[model samples]
Target: MNEAKKNSHMVGTVSELSVMLEYAKRGYTINLPTTPARYDFIAEKDGRSVKVQVKHGSTFNGERELLGFSKTPYNKRDVDVIAMFDSNDGTIYYIPTDHVEGMTSIRLRIEPYLYSVKSEKALIAEHYKKFIG
Candidate 1:
């Protein structure tokens, strides 16, 4: 792999590890896929299983105060949740896959803007924090 791709892979690896730790701490059992799959891993708890896709949230747009992450081409049946690792603040965010389905990219506003309409249904990073158990 090229340097950029290699570095990205490293980041993703770290993110997955961190997310696994979080899930384990919350009493969930973690399982890695034996073969190549769309999701990074499977997290099971209370007889429920969720396929998780790990993404490194390393990009931040200062002008818009938004955290940017590219949306992977995944169907609802392929992945259940997206775990985002915020490199800037070491924050882990869990977002339901359906929320970002069919999007090419995600630009999550970190904070609310005054001019922005409250009724707008934009993806806000803070809103996904509730998904973290």
Candidate 2:
């Protein structure tokens, strides 16, 4: 891999490990896919299984956290949830896959703009908080 790709892969690995740790702490049984799959891992709790795709959030425009999700020619993946780790603040957002099913990217700000009535960052963070734990 090229230097940039290597670094990005490293960040993704770290993010995935961090998320796995969080699930482990919550007593969820984690299972890695034996074959190539759309999802990264399967987390099970109380007999329920959730397929997760872990991603690393990076800065965009030097302020917003940007997460890109796509499968080359394919726009969507069959996963239950997307767990994004913000490397900036160490915050993890567990978003339902349906919310971003067809979108290729999403941006999150640290805080809402002073003059704006709504903030995508705040809204996304708030909506996904329920899935964090």
CA lDDT of each candidate? 0.74, 0.72
What is the per-residue lDDT of model 1 for residues 1-133, given as tens digits with 9 covering 90 to 100? 8999999888778888988888998898999999988888898899988898877775555633434465466467888888887776767778887888866455566666778465344477778876543
What residue runs in model 1 are displaced by over 4 Å at the alpha carbon? 63-72, 117-122
Candidate 2 residue 18 Cα shift, in angstroms, is: 0.6
Error of 2 at 119 (Å): 7.5
How do the residues 25-91 of candidate 2 rate in per-residue lDDT, one tens digit apiece? Answer: 9999999999998778999999898888887777665564455455532224578887888877778
- Candidate 2 worst ten-residue window by lDDT: 68-77
lDDT of 2 at 92: 84
Model 2, residue pairs in steric clash: none
Candidate 1 least-lDDT 10 residues: 63-72
